[model samples]
Target: MVRRANPAIQALKEETYIMSAVFDHGEFDHHEQIVFANDHQTGLKAIIGVHNSFLGPAAGGVRMAPYARMEDALTDVLRLSRGMSYKNALAGLPLGGGKTVLIGNPRTDKTPALMAALGRAIERLNGRYLAAEDVGMTLADMEQIATETSHVFGRDPKAGFGGEPSPMTALGVALSIRTCVRRVLGRDDLKGVRIGVQGAGAVGADLARQLGEAGAEVLVADVDPARAQAAASAAGGQVVGVGDILFADVDVLAPCALGAVLNDETIPALRTKIVCGAANNQLAEPRHGLALAQRGILYGPDYVVNAGGIINVAYEVSGTYDAAKVVEHVQRIPRTLEQIFEEAADEGLTPDVIADRMAQRLIGRS
Candidate 1:
């Protein structure tokens, strides 16, 4: 099937009633492709956004969410895919960025057939886009999709494939938080440094535990009470309510949950001296990063700070996979982040904008 590009599509952007109109608004200009996939038999309705592939074929994740509306899913994928492009650029990976989002209640609608349908949709992209597990997706789900197409990542380790990247991602985030502390807090140790974590999922839990073990005062909260309790227990920290996590007065605030948590309202409420997290798109918009900078808060660029997961997968994208090499690559994230911080300070630009410049330079796009 071929898509007809129409000049009139630009006018439709003003009509927010339609979701596809979002593409013509400016997203189409930033992205290389936006594909809507549907399979009636499997009931798979998904979208894949390939932001840029200047370095190589786009690589990101396949996410499934019970979004309230198709517009929500579209907004998420568009933002996430663009974030991946920056993530790759900052991580020094030779790959580009892309992401797939499946809209449905994962609890009931995600069947093996749906995974296969999503995989088939990816196959249609030929090798231009690769998929991995993200947010609501799992490694097992990626394996199921792998049955339909070879364009996937995060397979089981038993098959000599890369498994979940949460561990290394946690390591990278911890190191980044430390860098923030040293730069802004004027400290080299996290011991006795108060920290608040907003999310207790895989990466967040691991980050909390690591921080706790390092003698930091860690506080955590999650929408799921059980998860929050577990993470707090593992980290030897206290559990707070979801609403209180943002306003908690701490040296560093780590947001590990959803994107756009740093919008206008929350930025004003932030009491932390440094904002560093494992979440992507932490800023609701680019301006929010500048807002944080203007407030004298050190804001670690989300993509630059959280490149461990992508770095772990980038190893598999090239020649033979090496665990040691992947660990080395992920560990090097602190240096990359340090460079971003130094450059941002010297250039007097927000880390977000500076990191974007860094990425574009590497891919010859700057």
Candidate 2:
């Protein structure tokens, strides 16, 4: 029997209303799928959100986390899938938004057999949904899924054309940071800016390296102490604890960690002048972006800045992966950020609202 959702989960589900505006304007039908594994040892639960198929097949990432309730997973999948839809539209990919959330901790619950079972579940969905790496997932996990299914991304080393999306994503964030510095701090270069990066994963580490190369002081933190130390040492920066990153006294707080870090509680405590990174769904709610603006923080929209990965993946899936094309798209992030910020300032709205408007305009929904 499907369990009922508690109040907190219900509230998360309701948050999808903000995304509903774009979907309603586009007039796309949305589909939801839920899966439960019968394995006694590994009780895995998942929810897949297919927000639209107006363009082509639905594509997004599979996020795995230990949620306290099933409703939490459902809310995340729904919101993230909707974001993917907008992301595809803005990136000019012939794909719609879709996302899947495996309701368990990746640390202890993920197994080969369980992954295979999840692959079977994906196979059942057929071509309607394609999976890729997201929070709590890796390329190795995608490789495992490819053994059972073919509709996967991030497998083609050839598709990268000698450079993967991770670096491109970092580059996008770096460029946005530069733009933020110039606009918010009146500096044209990141020669000596101090940045506190909250995740030393692919995107965070890459951003840290880029910042260091550009002569920016970077402070890094990660749940894995070793990874944090390695990134900090390599970048010629200092390592801080994961919890201390949010309150770090730096010019920028780059959150490459999981989504929804900028909630009501964290928003009030942020100490950085700029908040920009490659993570998706950074805001716990739309109001958080407004709060950042109110606090004089230059906030870059997550979807706009993090679109480089999807742009690269789109080129790969289309069999026309070109480094120049990926670079062209990734480089546009700063311009997009500038436009969004300018529009937000002019219209007295949040960056996210302006970004959504731009995405809708690009997708022909506005």
Candidate 3:
């Protein structure tokens, strides 16, 4: 008797072949799927990149930005999606990595119709990807997306448990920074320790507040002067100029902004003992991790430190959202960082490299 080939298996083979060809160009990173979506009526343009699904459905946030070019939007989505994969794996969440980028200014261009269109696009993926809140999006914006689909996380608060993730993200980064201080500075407390926080957005502001509450001296900076002043006021911190934040003479540098800030030029100027924050893809490239290491900087791999937000959303996805459980899970972040640091020491490798290898092995990439 002859048997028929499973359609899913055949589809996987075809996808593998196509991806192999795309990989040769050095842009593709073994992503399982990429979808370009447009809606003429709503003037919505978006790209969704699903990096992997070995653990479960791809889960990530949808960020809206007024990217100057389509290519820039694509690059951000690809890098963010890949980062989500490593983040989830390290956090031990039963979810894969994916991300969506909406190419428009969220403040001026966002509309209910546009969000609905984006939701429909997510529905078309048939649960392969889940959308949550990210930069340029809010809980209310997520509600707009939820109007069209059920495959969404980081929704409105349920029984006052799960909602926006930035606060939790800040908590995780603060804890990880404390861990770094302990490891590199031989201090268990943050008392009087100076911390320079770049990007006074949601996560950065909250992180500055947390650091201040922990007895650390927080210096805040942002592209927007108002935001920087507000964050500094809230945290009782000093507002540093954006240009000088990177070179602030501090014990720690927390880059809570966009990616690629730790490039060739910034690494030499980083005047801190540790590099750790809520930013995704903080290292401009893999080599930048080694460069940080070479400079005697203890880098707390960004993905590992920023998993609290994802952990919170994962609980929302599991159908039973428990605030306590989510916090407990986030608390494990420092332990993971400690393990990564120990392994890096033993292997004589950068923490980021060690973390990437560990996450890759978890996701069947290695």
- Please give the clash total of every predicted structure, in order: 0, 1, 0
**After superposing candidate 1, which stretches have Cα over 4 Å from the reference?**
1-22, 26-29
Q: How would the candidate models be sorted by TM-score, starting from the highest?
A: 3, 1, 2
lDDT of 3 by residue, 256-345 (tens): 988899999999988999999998889998899999998999999999999999999999999889989999999999999999999999
Q: Quantify all predictions' global Cα lDDT against the true fold.
A: 0.86, 0.80, 0.92
CA shift of 319, model 1, Å? 4.4
Per-prediction TM-score, please?
Answer: 0.93, 0.85, 0.93
**What's the residue-level lDDT of 312 in candidate 1?**
79
lDDT, residue 224, model 3:
93
Q: For residues 1-366, could you state the per-residue lDDT of candidate 1 as single tens digits?
A: 898767577657634444446655544447888888989999899989998999889999888888898778888888888888888887888889899999988678879999999999999999899887788888889899999998888778787777897787888899999999999878889999999999998899999999999999999999999999999999889999999999999999999998899999999989999999988789887799889988888888888777888887777667467889888888888898888888888988888888888887776677
Candidate closer to the true structure by lDDT (higher is better), 1 or 3: 3
Q: By summed lDDT, which 10 consecutive residues of candidate 3 come out lowest?
A: 18-27
Runs of candidate 3 exceeding 4 Å displacement: 1-25, 158-161
TM-score of 3: 0.93
Candidate 2, overall lDDT? 0.80
Measure candidate 1: CA RMSD: 4.5
